[model samples]
Target: MEMVVLENEPEVLMENISNKDNRDTSAAPGLKLYRCVAVSFGLLCILQIALNISLRPPLNHTNCISNSEDMTTNLTEERDELKRKLDDLKSHQNVLKSERDELKRTLNDFAHRSNNGWLYFSHSFYYISPIKKTWHDSRNDCLQREADLVIINSKEEQEFIQRWVKNLMWIGLSKRDGIWKWVDGTRLTQSLWCAGEPNNHKDSGEECGEIRGCGHDHGWNDEKCSNSNFWICEKKMAL
Candidate 1:
């Protein structure tokens, strides 16, 4: 019985050892599979990181594109503003040039008037004849010179003539049908008659107008058309 027990114990020990070896082999295969899986996971993580790094530049480029667009828009607006300013300056320069040309024309006209034996006053030219003659002869002389007898149209003109004339002078006024009228056929609108004058003092048929001087009233007086007196001639400025 002792021998049989010993043999059985030895067999049991050998069987246990074999079973442990089989378990160890199975565990080894499982560990190898786990290592392969871990390595694959690590490679996937590295790939994802590399992909993220490579894509970042595109996002930055998008921002740069937006910034470039903004700068281009600003430059376009500035260019438009400069163009407008240049147009305005050109307009102002044109106006100034026109004004200068007008002034030059005016100066030229004054010089021409001065050269033509005419004195400029109140936008008109005047000439004091050096000789005395009858009213009709004086009017004829003025016509030959392309002028006419002076016609006083304003108080200022009358006063100016009063100061300018050295003696009595014949004007372009005359009486027709007892009504005073200018040579141009306009009726008299103002009067510079002296007090108590125009009495037709002798019924001598006073028909011509004269600026009375010779140390007298220096006012308007009617006289016979045949009377002799110095005269003033007037002409309009050339356009």
Candidate 2:
């Protein structure tokens, strides 16, 4: 319990205060550098967020346009494929129709050959009977054969008949109600009569028309219906 001097105590307190001040001043620069680094990092994060927001809408829009284009291209390709299929189907249908027509013609020709001795000429089938028959009976025979007596419409037809006939043949020409007509009810416009034919003989009444065989000029004549003669039949083709 000895009493200390006041002057020494004062000097010791001042030295301690000066040392604390020096320590505070030395730590201040490090604390300021740390605060500056933290502020720069926060600003960089905000800038990155703004950049992402600005680019997002354009990217989404580009993706939508690309999808739409792809869909349109797919639809166009599908439509073209369908059109090609339709065209192919139509072409095939036409070919089948042509084949069917050709088959029909062949069948008709075969049927004619099988039915009788038929000669094809000018889209018609002709049948010449070997035996002689009366003019009326000859017409009946043609009707039974699904035909009619030959009617010469053209000069080629008349010449062809004359060349093929070996004997007098009954034709479709006849006199009905005093007017010369064909079996089809057509009035006769031209004739290949043998100069003085169709006299309408008063004694025998030559009412039927006939064609004479080859070796004769203008091989046509009028004869009585009761007279016997070879006959010709004609039938049109199916098509």
How close is every model to the real structure, measured as TM-score? 0.52, 0.60
Alpha-carbon RMSD to native, per candidate: 10.5, 7.5
Look at candidate 1 and tell me the lDDT of residue 122.
84
lDDT of each: 0.84, 0.86
| Most accurate candidate by TM-score | 2
Best by lDDT: 2
lDDT score at residue 93, model 1, on the 0-100 scale: 100
lDDT of 1 at 219: 84
lDDT of 1 by residue, 34-108 (tens): 999999999999999999998775557788999999999999999999999999999999999998998898778
Q: Clashing residue pairs in candidate 2, if any?
A: none
